[model samples]
Target: MMTNILIVDDDIHILNLLTIHLSKDGYQVFQAKDGVEALDLLQEKSCQLAVVDVMMPYLDGFELTKKIREQYNIPVILLTAKNQIEDKEQGYAAGTDDYLVKPFEPKELSFRIKALLRRYDSRADDSVVRIGHTTIDKKSYEVQTGSRTILLPLKEFELLYFLMSNPLQVFSRDRLIEQVWGFDFSGDERTVDVHIKRIRERFSTLTDDFQIKTVRGVGYSLEAKRS
Candidate 1:
């Protein structure tokens, strides 16, 4: 199947440039002027990935990313003009799978897109991981325990899924950040703690089959309690 890519940006030059390059690379490109138009396009077409610009008239990239996370299981790459750490943090917190500063090489964007697509594709092949009665479905980006289904934000879900996949293996904050957020992540170790805390809070009352154990001065591990 040919890969479908959606590029959301208000800049006509960027749209045309990316469209030309991505098409040359054998990808089917979809263009939208803003988040509103992006969502409208999404409703009618199925895209494997999205590249969103930060600055838009009707809706911004962060907001669009959040909405896409809520409704779709595809990966998102956020494009921004600012190279500030805070803006990168905001983009990650908003659920972007990758980030690129503007005036970037189209080849670099292609490389990142290919990497993300491979990651998502590999996970989708055998995406379901389980501990005791709890289940994490990477394909659907959801968690289930008994009859209760939990929908976590993209980062939180990815964090939990990573830990559960390697149950009983300790991983440091840096490792988790690299594996989950990618090597380019600029956030501090505290970001891992925050996501781990949220995952614990979310699943604390949901199950007894497993628990995320913190190793002092080391890192964390998901230990299976029952099975």
Candidate 2:
């Protein structure tokens, strides 16, 4: 399937350049000039990835990314003129999956976007991600605990993969927002709570206890073990 991409930039020239390149690469493109319009469209449609400019009037890319992380798990590439390490760190903190300094070639950006999206595309087709007896099926969208096989919604499955991939690392909610949702998402920290709740409920029937850990105010971690 041709992936859907959303590009948000205030510069008409930059937006047009990206659109042309992305379309040539066989992606369906969507464009917006500001954060509010980007987030509004994101909420109403399905998208695989987003490329957002860091500087924009009203809401900047950092805030937009934080919002996206709250409700969606799409790849986000942040485009910024600020070259400082702290700025990059802030972008990562807000949930940008990748960062591109401004004045970059559109072709280069398209390549990076494809590479990022390919990781997700690969995971979606796998039958299982095995960690001991626990089985996570990417194709059927299910996670197995003991004898019970729990069905997973798309976001929940991606969450599981991210947690499982990282093992014991303590991820803050802000980081989870970035990794699971895109940087341009405008939801709140509590949104993560809701999804985690639903995921656990599905696992509950499969086992009296299972393996998604909460580190109090820190956030969540996934471990491969009996719960």
Candidate 3:
């Protein structure tokens, strides 16, 4: 099945550019001039992902992202000119799955779009792995520890899964970013740190059997501390 993508931007040129690139990559592309139109199209038919612009007339990208998150479990990439830390933070807070600054290479955008969509891809078998008492089900994005189960946000879950899958193999921040967020992702190392912190906080109370260890001056590794 051809993946459907929605491109929302007031600029016709941007919409055309994204449409051309995404369509060439075999995605069924749809375009909207603003958030309202995007929402309307979403109601009519669902899209696998959305590439949205920040500066739209009636509704901006941030608000549109929030609205999309309210009902859809789809990935959203905010394509915008704002590249400040605060702007990125705001985009994440608004529920955007990825952020791409303006003047971005279409190839880079394609990489990010494909990376985000991969999270939603379904597999033939349940991808489950167990480390001590902690059980991770990649298919469901749930981590089961003892009698309790916790659901993780996408990035944290991906990071945890990657580390657990390669237990004891230390991975640098750059490597983690490249493998998890895709090679063309423009975000820096801080992104890895933030997701690692969240994952550690979530799993800290669940079990001590496995620990995500920071290899000072190196990177991080998941070690099973059998008691």
Candidate 4:
């Protein structure tokens, strides 16, 4: 199946540029001028991935991303000129999958989109894994804390889902490095910390043991469900 992608940006040039390039790669492209419109379209129709801009009119990308986390596990890439570490943090905190600093190449954007879509596809499964109050339905790309839902971005949700599926299993950061981010990733274990912190923060209100635990000298593990 041809993958669907939604590009939400206020800049006509960026939108047009990305759409043109993505379509050539055989993605079913959808466009939105701002966050609100992007969301209305999302409610109406779904996409496999979304590319959002930071400085939109009515709703900013950050706000839109937080809202998107509420319902969808679709990958989102933030397109913006803001390159500061703080700005990237805000985007990641809001649950953006990837960040593209402005003045980027259309080819680069195409590559990033492809990477995200492939990552999403590799983790596809319907098996549901539960740990405490949290339940992850992999097939549906759904995350739940009992009945209350905690909105998570694509990477964070996938990270949590994998760990939960293999509870109480000690995985070295290197092993997690291999599975969660894939062997193609050359980054250090620090990337693991970032995603783990995000998961724990979201489930902080749900349960104490819903936490992803740090094993002191070892790596990490999700607490298993109590039957």
Candidate 5:
């Protein structure tokens, strides 16, 4: 299948430039003038990735990224003119999988896009992993235990799936963040801790088959318990 890429920018020149390059690279390009238009385009078309500009008229890139993160499980690249550290932090915090400063080479953007797509593609394998009585379904992004079915946020689900996939193996916060999020993740290790805490709290009463154990000064592991 040909990959679909959505480019959202108020700057017509930038949009055209990106569309030309991405299309040349064999991607089916979709164009949107602003974040609002981008969301509308998403509703009608299933894009594998989105390239969003930071300064849009209707909805800004950060807000658009947040909405996309909540509604979809696709990778997003934030395009901005500012190369400030604060802007990069805001972009990452807003859930962008990658960030690109304006005046960047089209080849660099293509490379970053390919890298993000590759990471996501690796995690898209259709497999069901079970630890004790709990089952983690990567295909459906659902968790099943006994008579209950649980749905978790995307990041939490990915984190749990990674740990459960390698049951009993300890993974440090840095490792987990790099594996679950991208290697370019700008957030600290606290991000992983927060996700782990939420996962534990959510499944505290849902199942007794598995536990996420913290390895002091290390990281976490999913230990299968006898039910």
Candidate 6:
């Protein structure tokens, strides 16, 4: 399968430049004009990684990075002109996996993308997590219960895997958003609610051995169904 990369920037020149270079390097590239459009694209499609610019309308790079982290496990590289240490610190705080200053060499950007993707893939390949009857194959992005296996969207899969990893341990919405999504996630806590609801629906008719519990004032937990 071809790797999909999303590039967000207001500059038409930068978008064209990256599209040409990344396509040549054998990547399927998607372009977005700003953070809002980037988020929409993410929801509509899955990309292996994102390269975003800082100064954009509607949503800036930092905020966009946070939102991406909250859902996807993919790497995010922030491309910007601000080279200050403080700026880089803020970018990391916003859940960016890497940072590249503007006027960057196309070769350098491509190399960083390759490195981040390899690192993330390695981590996934070595891990297999299970809860109740559901087995999460992190490497293949799948959930299996008995003989029925289902492929999940990126956010839903990550959310389920996180909760199942620590079965019965309650994670508040804020913490879930921070830990499962990304520490830099700045969106509404309700985003967690939406994903959790989706997981419940997916397993509703499929299994009775496990379920997600709402801790009311706290958050949610995955646990074996009570007989």
| Number of the predicted model whose lDDT against the real structure is largest | 1
Worst 10 contiguous positions by lDDT, candidate 4? 123-132
Over 1-227, each residue of candidate 5 has an lDDT whose tens digit, in order, gives: 99999999999999999999999999999999998899999999999999999999979999999889867889999999999999998887787889998889999999999998997786676488877778889889999998789999999999998898878888878778866897568999999989999999998988878899999998999988865
TM-score of candidate 2 to 2 decimals:
0.65
What TM-score goes with each of the models? 0.65, 0.65, 0.62, 0.61, 0.65, 0.60
Global lDDT scores for all candidate models: 0.92, 0.83, 0.86, 0.81, 0.90, 0.89
Task: Put down candidate 4 lDDT per residue, 132-211, tens digits, no spaces.
Answer: 66678876778877677665787787788778766778777876765567646878999998988877777777776455
lDDT of 1 by residue, 1-227 (tens): 99999999999999999999999999999999999999999999999999999999989999999899778889999999999999998898777899999899999999999999998987677689988888999889989998999999999999989888878998888778867887578889999999999988888887888889999998999999964
Give RMSD to native, each candidate: 8.8, 6.4, 9.2, 11.8, 8.0, 9.3
Model 4 ranges with Cα > 4 A deviation: 126-161, 164-227
Itemize residue pairs with steric clashes in candidate 5. Answer: none
**Model 4: lDDT to the true structure:** 0.81
Q: Can you write out model 3's per-residue Cα lDDT over 65-147, one digit (the tens) per residue?
A: 88887778789999888779998978876768799999999999999988878766642233987888888898789989999
User: Candidate 2, residues 1-227: lDDT per residue as tens digits?
Assistant: 77899999999999898899999999999999999999999988799999999999989999998888777778899999979999998998887889999878888898899899987677565556776666776667777767777777788887876776567788887777766785666999988889888888776556543377899978988766653
Which stretches in model 2 have alpha-carbon errors above 4 Å? 132-162, 167-227
Comparing 4 with 6 on lDDT, the higher-scoring candidate is 6
Candidate 3, which segments miss by more than 4 Å at Cα? Answer: 122-129, 136-207, 211-227
TM-score of 5: 0.65
Q: Write the per-residue lDDT of candidate 6 for residues 1-227, one digit (tens) a residue.
A: 99999999999999999999999999999999999999999999889999999999999999999899877889999998978999897897787889999999999999999999998886666567765576887788989998998999998998887777667888778767777666656789989999999999989999887889999887898887665
Error of 4 at 120 (Å): 1.1
Flag the better candidate by lDDT, 3 or 6.
6
